[model samples]
Target chain A: EAGVAQSPRYKIIEKRQSVAFWCNPISGHATLYWYQQILGQGPKLLIQFQNNGVVDDSQLPKDRFSAERLKGVDSTLKIQPAKLEDSAVYLCASSLGQRVFTDTQYFGPGTRLTVL
Target chain B: GQQVMQIPQYQHVQEGEDFTTYCNSSTTLSNIQWYKQRPGGHPVFLIQLVKSGEVKKQKRLTFQFGEAKKNSSLHITATQTTDVGTYFCAGADTNAGKSTFGDGTTLTVKP
Candidate 1:
């Protein structure tokens, strides 16, 4: 089976510029997630989607960040007016369901964003 | 809010040495998982523990979940250069309906 796929493995943008990252999850997976991982820090959940419906996005910066999982297979995460602190790796993962205890997650290579 | 913390942010040992990393949670976790990320790579799932005091092993790696469900540990035996990476623990709280990841423990093996 193919693994999760992400586009533009790396990106560089200036502060206040807008950037978007795209992800295509493994086929047949029902849960998709977007996470932001800062250097020397663990991944922070930005948003989660279950079959096109958002399951959680409490940590998402509503004012600057937004994500969508249209058709429930692929996802896109966008950040407008990017800040220097927003320079981090954005990872995309997918699982069969919300059963984190039982389901194994497949992660993408991730898009490393550098905001100058 | 739930928080997961891993101890020994970094560890360096000889190839024949044993290394261990611990993870603690502010709240009881319904389950805990382990992931490994090599430098410049994304995390890959290692294993998941659900039952209290559960212990699982994979080759030279051993994972244990505390009986209290608030702590966990990963131990590696006779570390090799291939074992160099950051190990992360992610805890899931059923009530919170989410999982939290620890900062991770980076391990280095010196041959």
Candidate 2:
């Protein structure tokens, strides 16, 4: 059973630059999520997708952040004109379905974005 | 907006000592799950509690869900160096599919 996979374990960019992170969830998983974890803080949910459709993205910064899961298996989260405040880890997680209470989520290694 | 809080933010203990962390929520939670993340690693699921006042144990780790379903605790006995990590508690809303995670409690074991 392979775990969730993410690309570019670490990234560094200047303020106002753009950055993107990719995530490939566990096999057969039906739900995917993107979270932002600032240092010393818990991971904050940015967006959630059930298959190719978005389930929730209320916390996403519409002006700067966007994410998509075109095939329902892989996802990409992008931040344009990134700010210093966006310096945090981008974590990707997956679960079997929306009934998460009955399912456990598997997380990827995460991409640490450092905005200077 | 829902919030789940965990404390104390950090703790250090001798290898043979015991440790515990608490999680509280502003609203009643339908279910709660726990995860542990080692330094520089991703969070791994530990356990889940659904019914109010449920208690589960795995080896030296004991998890308890409050009778009110708004609070929970994780207790570790005779901690070892391998137990060093941050433990997080996530609470799921009764009406929503997403879960809100707490800041987490970092535990350091002195070997």
Candidate 3:
């Protein structure tokens, strides 16, 4: 089976520019997550979706960042008026979405964004 | 808020040497999961520990969870060059309904 897929493996933009990324999780997976990983650091969760509903997004910067999983299988993360700190790799992962929360996540290759 | 910390930000060892990384959480974790990320690659899940004091082994790697479920450790025996990568521990808090990841320990195996 194919793994999670992401578009535009890499992107470069100037500070204050807007950017968007797309993700397509594996078939049959019901839970999806978006993470931001800065160089040399672990991934930080930005948002999570259980099917079409938002499960958690407390860490997301609502003022400039937003994500949505409209149909429950694909997702999009956007950053408006980006900052230099926003230059990082965006990763998307998915799991079986068990009610009890015990599932191994599968990750995509991720999109590396560079903001000048 | 829950915070996960990893020790020895980085490690470099000759092949056949042993290596260990520690993970500690400010609050008790419902479960802890380990992941490995190669340079320029995304993280891939390696294992998960759900029960307190649980110990699991895979080949030359051994994973241990603290009895209090607030800490965990990963040990690599006789490391090989293939083991070079960043290892991260993620602690899940059911009450918070989220998982927090440690900064990660980058391992370099000199062949």
- Interface RMSD of every predicted model, in angstroms: 1.1, 1.1, 0.9
What TM-score should be assigned to candidate 2? 0.98
> What tens digits encode model 3's per-residue C-alpha lDDT throughout B1-111?
999999989999999999999999999999999999998888999999999999999999999999999999999999999999999999999988879989999999999
Candidate 3 local Cα displacement, residue A59, angstroms: 0.7
TM-score for predicted model 3 compared with the true structure: 0.98
DockQ for every model, please.
0.83, 0.80, 0.80
Query: Listing every candidate in turn, what is its Cα RMSD in Å to the true structure after a full C-alpha superposition?
Result: 0.8, 0.9, 0.8
Compute fnat per model. 0.83, 0.77, 0.69
Stretches of model 3 off by over 4 angstroms after superposition? none
List, residue by residue over B1-111, the lDDT tens digit for candidate 1. 998999999999999999999999999999999999999999999999999999999999999999999999999999999999999999999888889999999999999
Per-residue CA lDDT of candidate 2, range A1-116, in tens? 99999998999999999999999999999999899999899999999899999989999999999999998899999999999999999999999985855679899999999999
Report lDDT per candidate.
0.95, 0.94, 0.94
lDDT, residue A53, candidate 1:
96
Clashing pairs in 1: none
Q: Report the CAPRI category for model 2.
A: medium
RMSD of 1: 0.8
